[model samples]
Target chain A: MDPQSVERPPSVLLAHRMQGHPVLVVGGGVVAQQRLEKLVPTGARVTLVADHFTAAVEQTALQCPQQVRLVRERYRESHLNLEPYWRLILVCLPSGAANHSDDAKGQSKSESDSEKVYRDAKRVFGAQQSVNVADVPALCDFYFGADTSGCPTGKGEGQLGSMQLLVSSNGVAPRYAALVRDELVRHLGELPLAQSLDRLDELRAAVREEAPGPEMVAVRMDWVCALTDRLGLRGAASMDVQEELKKFKDYCKERGEQVKSPSQDN
Target chain B: MDPQSVERPPSVLLAHRMQGHPVLVVGGGVVAQQRLEKLVPTGARVTLVADHFTAAVEQTALQCPQQVRLVRERYRESHLNLEPYWRLILVCLPSGAANHSDDAKGQSKSESDSEKVYRDAKRVFGAQQSVNVADVPALCDFYFGADTSGCPTGKGEGQLGSMQLLVSSNGVAPRYAALVRDELVRHLGELPLAQSLDRLDELRAAVREEAPGPEMVAVRMDWVCALTDRLGLRGAASMDVQEELKKFKDYCKERGEQVKSPSQDN
Candidate 1:
């Protein structure tokens, strides 16, 4: 097998559009609703395929006008009317062949059964379309990343950071990835450098376009971040740091004062 | 509603037992094996319950000394009978509903009535153990977080400033937080702060045990981080500034370092 023929992992800022694509979301519960929420925002013409749905999914379906469609039955290969309408399909079912328990006790499906669904869904969606599963990593084109809203805006508006993906090189459990994702998230949230990067990205566009060179840009960013940390507690540290540096440089040039280096400033 | 009687969100830590406990990991596919990989290290007697398991789960069951119970028949509620042996159950099944596709497809009852098997299995597991279905947040006891395995020690260690929780207050989507986590992890990796924080934690323990006062400890830490950043930088700018500062300080000390005013430094 040639390595060049193998599939590649998705990177940040790939920006694929789902808008206006007739997409089918399989599964009636909250997971399906969550998937729909993301898909709808991307402008996918979503069709809900489930005999029953939670109130949230029903509400979402009602709100979307003609953009959303609902089916009133469990999934069948025939229901997957691969007519000209449906372009993308999202499988949001539980994996079966369960080692834990059976369904009457509200237990999950068997693992092989789950894999069968994954294989079936993948077959329907094919490689060209986005086939995402809510919790099943084995059948997903992409795992939804975590998003941060209401941060002071700069370059990437509504960008996601600090994400976790559920991928199976050998095709396996999505739930296990969930555990890893949660722990990584909590740990990353408190890191100081993550905060600094948030600030660094603000000036990244400016640096890319206007800086004398990449080295100077990198050095200037380092200096700016360091200066921001040196200053007393302030919100929007990056913007404030840049503004203060500009003011200081202007003051020094106007007054003919020798501008002291950071090391000597103390 | 009485404020005192109001229930708050439970703070639960899923402690992986050092001595190991019986953990029934449902689904006998790659995902089940993946769950087993994480569980075995914590010492869990893992039982893979599935009608059909993949080669990986089968191999893991064979290699591990922990009790491996494989039910090759279609799953039923009796599968949940390991209550005396297993208390914690992880449902990684592909779907929670009855597997009725075979009946619809005109398959024989003995060979294809998987839906009946699934329904019976679900009835035994109950809602608390039903984690496989999407939009079943109330059914789950824990949500997993992401991890970065790039640290030099291999063991996930180190702390950041403050306890930060990246929450979706409105519960729009949790995965978007991943993108934020990615940016943060990369940023934190670049900074000296995380390593310094680890050192600072050691100093903090010492200070808390022996320091004269908290204010003194705070001032000491403040100056330490400030000076370390200044000295750690490369290039002539840092060197020239440090040399100038040393000369100024020496000159002042040589002149008897007298402070005639209250605000002056000697």
Candidate 2:
């Protein structure tokens, strides 16, 4: 049995809602910048510690002063004691020029050197702190997919910040996983994923107003849920909101009766 | 902008690899059981606190005694201070009589009753601890997708445990997301996803052995990456692994020369 395979378990994908939460980043290179790009959207209060930072990192910190705090010095144990303790730590330290050359395939020297560094840092961090170390899978508590394209962007109908689709193979076959992700993203673009959702949300709200009774709650949910199928993927994109609301009002009278008048044992 | 929208920020999807790590799950009904199903696959050491548990939950706990620890009591502050303080806490308490009737849509009586409970629990938990309360989106630090079907099931070609394709709308349009997920799963069924990946992995390993040395590292990676395209999606599934390995060894000689003999006007 491969020791490495045993080290890596299946990844449990989650939606981490880190609004107004303090997070620590321990590097300031392009890799660290990439982590920040993902973190900034979550609205996390990030404190970046590094000897020096890239121009992009400096600009980002300057832009989001309140969201980001910069520490212009090397790392120390005391840095962990920052007033508002950071529960999530992203270690973005340099793992010896990996992309610089193919010598990285040498494996033994580079692997052990970086592995030792990553292992040492993981040990020193607080037991409670979840460390996500870059370049080292074994040391990471969680893996950042680090792709923003999954979240649809743009103004009006195209902007669906909530729409998140992810494809992963737990690093077994990342190339294939990425290929499938691209295919899905293209498929999502053709469909009105955001617009349909927005319409359904509005329709749900409208139905709630029309049927203002507790008894109508299940009816509304079931009705809206059914409507989702009726709308399917494309129908809601071209739906008439006001006309649908009026139509829903008339249909509710009959739908409500159907559920109440249960002819058979449920 | 709606106030609800203000509270609910866009979700950041992360692949959490929680193997042999301690996680706490409060409550032990159907909802907690749902959460346990997701956690069990991650190999997380879970401590579930609840007065009573569902049959499924009890069976799972008994089966994986090493992974799950059950506390037959109501939740207390001290539960947070267990020997290994749980960084991730899942609160799965009953949010009133939801699913019982249409009263769930009242938005006032049941909403406030459950909202207050979720809010109060969120406040009492450790400042650093990330809590995921069932149903209360605002109170949750993170949201459990609570679905494991994304990871392919069964054995042989179908057993792609690593192949995880997730579709989410951040709760904005769950119905639509689910519809798309079902479609993708059906699409995945027809493709030999795991077989191709396994073949590619074997090919890469074989090439690394055939073309040994620091210089061949770049050549090996580039060659394997290019082969991924040549093999494409279905091509690798039907590929002969032994024959392919032999071909890769022969190809290495020509590929190495191409990189070395760079043509330039200069």
Per-prediction DockQ scores? 0.01, 0.41
Model 2, range A14-111, lDDT digits (tens) per residue?
Answer: 77777888888878888789778777877888989888899999999999998888998766545666744565788777643333222334345545
**Global lDDT of each model?**
0.42, 0.64
Best by TM-score: 2
Grade the docking of candidate 2.
acceptable
Model 1, B1-266: lDDT tens per residue?
Answer: 21111111211111121223455665676556656655554445677667779887777677775555666644444665754434345555543333433234443444323334334334454321212212223333334333222222232224322112122211112222233334444444443433433343343333323323322333433433454344441111123433333443444345444322212232
The candidate 1 chain A region of ten consecutive residues with least summed lDDT is A167-176
Which digits, one per residue and each the tens of the lDDT, describe model 2 over residues B1-266? 22124355565677777788888887899878977877887788988988899999999999999998899977655566664556577877764433322234534554543343344344554355566776556666676542334333434225554666566666665666666666556666777887877787677656655655444655765667676667776787788877766666557555554333222311
How do the predictions measure up, each by TM-score? 0.32, 0.74
lDDT of 2 at A139: 64
**Looking at model 2 chain B, which ten-residue stretch has the lowest summed lDDT?**
B257-266
Q: What is the TM-score of candidate 2?
A: 0.74
